[model samples]
Target: MNLKFIKRNIFPLVKIISTVLITSAIGLESWNIYAFLTNRNVPSSLNPIFWIERFAMTSHFIESIIAAFYAHSGKKMPIQYATYTFFVGTIGLLELFDQEND
Candidate 1:
């Protein structure tokens, strides 16, 4: 593939994918956090079937929150930050950092 083609395609593709992933992450994390705070989430129910998902979500939430703080404090973005921000799913830290960088 040509550099020109890649340059045109990849950035836009990345933006689109990142936007979608981040949005979903925010939604899911928020939902899980709410459910968790109220003790109504599946994890709280102690269903074996939900354990993996709960564990994954919990970890994701933890990572994302840390990433958010890191991004907010003007630190470099780690690959994990992308994962976290994507999971955090809000529109704040990413936009803040993007504007700060620009």
Candidate 2:
């Protein structure tokens, strides 16, 4: 197995999957908030997920800011990297690092 080939192909696939999964999680968290606001009954099992999702969202926001800073320092488009990092988290940051390396 060639390492470059795997990094070029598989890494992008991983990023796409990560973005989808994270976005879906945020969507679920949004629903949880809406449910709570509308006085809907939320299951006890989901209570834990609600808190976890909140933490994840906060972490991702911070990561996005870091990504923007990195991109700006590298003379790349900060907004693009920041938006991508917001959706894909660390995977997007990894990609930015890889681009810098290249």
Best by TM-score: 2
**Which pairs clash inside model 2?**
none
Error of 1 at 31 (Å): 0.6
Reference-based lDDT, residue 73, model 1: 56
Q: Estimate each model's TM-score.
A: 0.42, 0.79
Listing every candidate in turn, what is its Cα RMSD in Å to the true structure after a full C-alpha superposition?
8.0, 2.1
Clash totals for all candidate models: 3, 0
- Quote the positional error of residue 10 for candidate 2 in Å: 2.8
Over 34-102, each residue of candidate 2 has an lDDT whose tens digit, in order, gives 988999987888878777877888888999999999996666798988988988888778778878888
What TM-score does structure 2 among the candidates reach?
0.79
lDDT of 1 by residue, 1-102 (tens): 896686477655765665675566556667777888997754545455245545645665665676656664565465556464545433335444566677
Query: Which pairs of residues collide in model 1?
Result: 25-87, 26-88, 26-89
Instruction: Report how far residue 102 has shifted in candidate 1, in Å.
Output: 15
Judging by lDDT against the true structure, name the best candidate: 2
